[model samples]
Target: MVEDGASYWRRNLLIVWISQFLSLMGFSFSLPFSPFFIRDALGVSADSQVKMYAALATASSALALAVMSPLWGILADRYGRKPMLLRANFAGAIIVALMGMSPNITAFIALRMLQGLFTGTMSAAMTLMACCAPRNRQGLTLGALSAAVYSGDMTGQFIGGLLVEWYGFRQAFLYSGMAIGMSGLLVLLLVREDFQRPAPVIKTAETARNWHFKLGIVLSCLPLYILLMMSAFARSVDGSQFALFVEFLNGGVNEAGAARWTGRAAAAGCIGAMLSGLLIGRLLDYFRPSRVARTAALGAMLAMALIAIVPVHMLGMERVALDIGAFGLYFHDQAAPAVLALVPLRFMMIFFSAGLEPVMNVWLSKITPASQKGIVFGFAVTWRSIGWIFGPLAGGTISMLWGVEAIYVVGPFFFLALVPMIGWVLRKIRSRLES
Candidate 1:
């Protein structure tokens, strides 16, 4: 049964958080460096084809996720969220393991689609947490969950890269699959739910339900979905091809070195994202959601602009020396290559952009009715999936047409474009508040 106290919510949140940490870590292990896997393992020789194949690998799964999220969400409402979590976790374990055994690019892409079709642990976890968490504390709960995602992803990417460098992509994929399988086991054994399916409605009530659903979605959900989609697009636009860019920077170095640098940069970004989750949720709980989102969007724009110049080592800040006489703050010159500069810039960009997601998530949960949360989140994932589809393709096309440099050039605009939409959301949120 759902208890009306802190312990009840805290217990579920803890389990969900741990589960998410493991699952996301597993996911980050393989997906983040797929481009490297394609180039080095699958033996893709053409730069353009490498970019295109990487995009397809992500896009295929996204397309399938877009089609399936709604159905799985409806099932959650009917059967309960635990089953959905189990489904995603267990299926993810198997499919992700299968990826390690893929023989060629086509097989890898096909497996990616299957992974998307069957796995969506994040959405499952979110809906379940939103349902169980106390209404007033949902922001904190979700924010913490987001932190676990970043923390796990940070760990996974770093380790996965090392594993890839040492063993191969196959071993990394296998280990990641094991991690996800373990997460499912944890959920099954520890998590508890008291979900009651909603009673069926007759024709007249169903008609009213349809009207209310449309009105609710139009008034509250659409803007949040747009913002979520925009976030997905901005984050993934260059993500799939990141290792390729790093390899390019390495002056045609081996994939092992490329994998290591890619892992380092990705791990740094996750750390930034992890820290952002720490502060953004607390602020969102007390501040206007739209205002927080707008600030994050703007911050993300500036950060991306900085990242764009990292190829030049951000004006030679990659190495510096300073000495304080009395302050006891002594520093020495840290000489590093120009390409190493991208790590901190990537971190900053993720930190700023990452805040936008939680803001929107809290906003959506606040407006959604408890009973419809599953269906609503399902569609939300669909919208996010749309962004994933477009983002990979856009990143590939931009990088292919103009060179990898174009990725950093074009990325800031995605966040820049979110500012006006955030204003629109702000007004809607304010109206909801006043009403």
Candidate 2:
């Protein structure tokens, strides 16, 4: 009977992992190219206008998400996590499809806001998995799910780039919607929840007195929340401008070529994230999650600094290949190695950045009562959305003022500054655990 129960939950985890991959992939399909979509498809040709509109689009979605996450989370806790996952997937499909049909930037931004308001597939999925998985394997389970997310995101970026090159930006949204719809279908068919809502409690003098203790628990978790915010901010600060940065690098390349290169770079980062998900997810099972997070943050900080200062040509190597065959057929190929210099650094950054989410999730799962998982995770998502809201806006304005490369130079500082806080939090968590 025990073995059967274990197999049952494991099967659910597999299904949820696949569903997360598809859902995230669908959302990311056109994300990397949104700025270009604004400039080209929306006819916003001015650089400043493009930056402003793109930033607005990014921030608006995050803003709505920030506002709505807590509400949805409470509902998920009261009802069941599966319904929330289904809600997000179905709503995301409709919103993304509508985005493809939008006639102007304003309409597009509105659709994106709706996407944020109704969809939080990641958080919802995480809640479901956390609730269902055995306590001892939370790290591994969440980490595996994280890998799926990165894999999906990487696949989406590459395919989205190709789609944009072939069919234009609008079509990417239609494809994204289709992918999300498939994910929803998978959930409807495969996912099972045995959630039982907590029984209502009667208020007593003792219960009223325990309010302060509950507040203390929330306060104790504040540092983790801050770390989540900083991690998100550091990563996203460069995200809005990354494609533009690639375009800047490829001075002579056509728009399609630049988009392709950007996709390649983004995909490389996602590969790093996938690797991290596998490695770090396991590490969390053995070590203090905060310690792992600290190491990753330091590595990411150094890599971002290097990425900012290093010349692309210096980091690249050249290779030539010659093919000889019958009938005197000979072909020679030369590759510019410098174009790939940032790929490794990007990998390093993403590897570490990827560690933050699952580790943080594991820690939260350990600290918070299971009954409150939905609301607490929702709060974490809110903090992430707040970071997403501000990071892109700040990145956009800075890119406009100091050039796109400047964002990279500024990004490392966000991580660098958070190291001390991380250390302090780790100590507090350890002290509490030991006592």
User: For residues 85-135, what per-residue lDDT tens digits would candidate 2 score against the true structure?
Assistant: 999999999999788787889998999899899998988988888777777
Give the true-structure RMSD of model 2. Answer: 4.1
| Whole-model lDDT per candidate | 0.83, 0.81
Model 1: CA > 4 A from native: 1-7, 200-220, 254-256, 313-336, 433-435
TM-score of 1: 0.91
Candidate 2 residues lying further than 4 Å off, grouped into runs, are 1-7, 199-216, 252-256, 311-338, 431-435
Candidate with top TM-score is: 1
User: Model 2, residue 309: what's the lDDT?
Assistant: 72
Displacement of residue 207 (Cα, Å) in model 1 is 6.9
TM-score to true structure, per model: 0.91, 0.90
